[model samples]
Structure formats: C-alpha cells, structure tokens
Target: MDAYWSPLCTACEGLESGSVLVTPVSERPFEIEATRDDRIVVKFRDSGEERPLHREQFSVLVDRLEGSPITLETLAPGVEPYAAVLSLGPEFVSDGEALSLALDEAVGGESPHLLTPEEARTRPERVHDDAVLLADLLDRVDADDPSSLDTGTLTDLYVLLSDVQRGADRVRGTARNSLLERLGPDQQLHGRFGTVRRTTRERRYSKDDEIIFDALDEHDVPREWVLGVDPEKLDVVLAVTDLDEDDVYDVDEQVYVQKTGVDEGEKFSRLQGLAERLEEVEGGEAIQEDLLEIERRIDEALASG
Candidate 1:
C-alpha cells in the first residue's frame, strides 16, 4: 500500500484545517492547504511555500528533499528567526497585499542566505535547541547522582549520553563549518564567549581487494578477520550469486529506534580539540550597537584576539 498518501483523503476529510503530516525523523513539517477534488495542497512548514501534490507525487518530492539534504542543526523548530522565516512565528515578508516567503531550499554548505525581513524584528529569539537537550540530560544525571559503579541501569545512561554527545557534535560541526568558511581553515576565530581554531587531519582508507589482500598476506594477518570480503562487494555478490545466501553469509535483522541525521565524526573531534585549546579571555560582551559600531567592535575583538 502507498505510505504518506494512503490516509491523505481520509485525514483531510477528518480535520477542520486540512491534513497535516510531518516526517518521522526530522519532524520536517508538511501540511495540506485545502482539499480540491482529486488534488491535495501540500508543503513543508519551513518551506514557506505550498505545492499541489497529486496523491502519487510523494516519492518525487521525497527524492528532491533527500537529494538536497540540510544539516540537522538548521532545522530546530520554534526558534526565533528560523521560526519566522518558516512562517511558524508571527509574520513573513509582504509585497504590500500578500505575504512572501523564502522559496530557496536550506541545504548544502555554508553559503549566505538572503536576509529575510522577519530576521530584523525577530533576532532576539535565537537560542540553540541543544541547550535544552543538554539541560534535560544534566537534570537526569543530577536526579540520580549516579557514579560509574552505582548506577541503576547503565543502558539508558549510555544511550542518553551518546545522544547528547552526537547532538553537541552536530551543533559544533555546523558552527565550525560556518566559521571556517569566513575565517581561514588554518586560523582561529574569536567569538564573544570562545575562540575556535581549525586544523586539518588526514584519514586514509582503501577498498581494492588486491592491495588489501597483498598487505594482509605480507603482514601474515588473518584475512578472515574481515570476513575475507568487503561488505560492499559482498552485497553485490549476494545480489547475483547462485549459491545459498545463508551458506555465504549470516544475516541478522534487528529493529531499533534511532535519531536520524548527518553527524560528521571527524569534524566533531576537531571541534572538541578546538574547545580544549580555548583560553579564557577576560572582557565583557560587546554591547548592542549600530552597524558601524558593531563592525568596529568586531575589528577590535579580532585585534585583541
């Protein structure tokens, strides 16, 4: 059976304001604007636009969206400027009579997004959702006051801790990339609260069976440690081979819920290193000022750093 649209008509008919559907992982919100005969008006909430999706058009949109993936950090709901730009907050840009919204997809590298009118009025509402996540995590830890030996259940603690690390890494990775784009990758960026440095690390890996097997043979290493075949190649083999699949490989299928999004582990490590290198610079935060004054303050900050 069809997935998102299987209940579309029924859902729309049931609701007073048409049908609303959000994605499972990202909470990427989409809704039906209104019912029109055979078509349903659909759009992601943050998209600031709507689409007339034929019931069969779900796959096409999903393909486009997944093709142009945005970072998880940018998708925090109910935040200030983001919320306003998403049309979830108070208002949006207007061309006198009608409201206008940003139609561009918020995906890809750190490129300049056009300033929205909502930004100016809604700047003060900025707060990273990660703070709330971390706060909750800290609260849980404090409630139990568990130590390494005396914890009630290590499973929940381990899972939550890992999630917190990943969430922090996701935010830090986004911030690092943003700063790296503006500042040189080899340079340090001075912020109001902290300084961030960028450094390069080299990671090497190979997939060629010839080279891999030759190195293993030369080192007298057991080749079976790696199942004697790369998983990717094994996958291809499984698709076409005539042999019993179970004889070649054992498959175990287990289901579990997980937080879904991109997390660059290497970038996170680099960010963590940067955090370690941070020094406490004694000064007050620069007060809010006009554009020129802000520019001067930035220049002063850089000079001081």
Candidate 2:
C-alpha cells in the first residue's frame, strides 16, 4: 500500500522552508510517508515497517542545509578595517577582479561593512539573538533561587536559542561576503579552516560543573550542575574543550580515562634519550637491537609501570 500523505503534517512543515532535508541513514532506507501534529510517519523501504516518530526526534535522521563552504578569516579591527577577510585555500588565490566579483555575488552590494566592537555593542539590535543570552538563562537555572523558572521554561529557552543561532548564521553569511571583498589580489591564505557541526538539538554545558561536550558523548548531568558563566568565559571554556555546536553525546555521568601514547614518569624521557642515541648511531643500524630493548621497556612501563 502506498504511504498516505496527510495535509495535517505540521511536523514536516519545514519541508517547505528548504532548511531541512531528510535522507535515509546509510544503513536503512526509509520513506517519509506523512507528518501529523508533531509526529512524522516513516516507512522502511526494505521491511515495509512503518512508525511514527516525534518531529523533534525524527529531525536527527536528516541534515540541514548550511551555507557555502568558503572560510573567512576573522580579523581584529587594528589589523584590518573589515571584521574578516575571505580565506581561499592555500593553492587558490583570488585576483582583485575575482574577489570583487565574489563579494558582489555574496552581498549584492558595496564592499563589506565592518563593525567595530563599539559599534557592534551599541547596535545590540543588530546582533539581538546571541548565545550570551542563553548562557545567562542557564546561569539563572543553576542558581536554584525561588524566582527560578518552572520546568516548562526550558522549551521557551530552546526556542529563543534557535532563533539566536539562526540570527548568528545570517550574520556570519553576510560577514563572509564582506570579508571576501577585503582579500587582496592573489593573496594567499594558509592553514585549514575548522568545521563546525550544527544541529537542531541543544545540550547543556557548564564550566564549573565540569562538563565537556565531545563527539559521540552524551551526559545527563543534573540541573544543579548547570553553571552561570559570562560569554567571554564560556568562549574560553569551549575553546579548551574544543566542543563545537552540533555535537551530540550520550549522557553518561561516569568518568573515563583518555590514553596518550607516551609512557608516564621517567620512561618517556628515557625513550626520547634512546631515540636520540639511535639517531647518533651509525645509520642507526648498530643500535637497532638496543633501540628495540628500550622500546620494549617503554611499552612495559606504559602498560604496567
């Protein structure tokens, strides 16, 4: 039987927005049959087994369309009049004409408009939806005061968080366009651009609470663990943890050890000495047996010492 389509599938309304696209997970091919209320009905192509999943739950099955892959180098105002500049790959350099054309295509207007920190701060309306606000709310939630919000406020908080994120994305796209105009003709940009993972889901992060967001990690830290943090501090903490947006992890409260290849204590230094000795040996041929012995000792130290 053909999967029925329902006009009432409000859950799939984003299908019309072009922001969300659904595709089967590589392992299982599923056809989206219909959406109703907050649920999406999907039928597995192979098994013909149909199921209804909450829209929020089903969203993880698909991907959202983010903007262009072009990277932008964020610059300090002292270094450049613009907030950022186009960062083409090391091998590719854009001529002035190419940069101008790309900039025109990106913003459809004059050269990039740079925002000074003072200007940016004065015009709060421009960057209205910011992560700073979300961080503030989490702070309040952690305080456990009588005026603390009810449990239902979390939904509202998430909605606002999404709005802020979308606003930031729109701003970033414009910044990228502006930065493209700043690139000098044939200017080379070295270093690989970092990638960020974005998602519709939000997870709580706390610095004082000792939570680190890692890929493939999940945590169920209690609400009490949510810590208050200023935006700058939060940025620093995230940089240290290296957790970007869109990381989803299972919520586990247990601590686990991460292994580094080097052995602990004096053995690692001794291994270095052994390596230097091998390098000094004639073609490193005579010390091959000695090197092997040292490596064996280092491995034993790493494993048991």
Q: How well does each candidate superpose onto the true structure, as a TM-score?
A: 0.32, 0.19
Task: Please provide, for model 1 over 10-77, each residue's C-alpha lDDT reduced to its tens digit, 9 standing for 90 to 100.
Answer: 54445434224443234555555665554566566567677664534434433433445333234434
Could you say which candidate leads in TM-score?
1
- In lDDT terms, which candidate is top? 1
Q: Candidate 2 — which pairs collide?
A: 9-35, 217-249, 217-250, 218-249, 218-250, 218-251, 219-251
Q: How many Å off is the CA of 16 in candidate 2? A: 39
Candidate 1, superposed: residue stretches over 4 Å from native: 1-8, 13-29, 36-39, 53-134, 140-144, 148-154, 185-187, 202-305
Residue 151 alpha-carbon offset, candidate 2, angstroms: 3.7
Worst 10 residues of 2 by lDDT: 81-90
lDDT of 2 by residue, 208-291 (tens): 323353311365544545435466876677678878733633445788543223222233233345557668968786545543
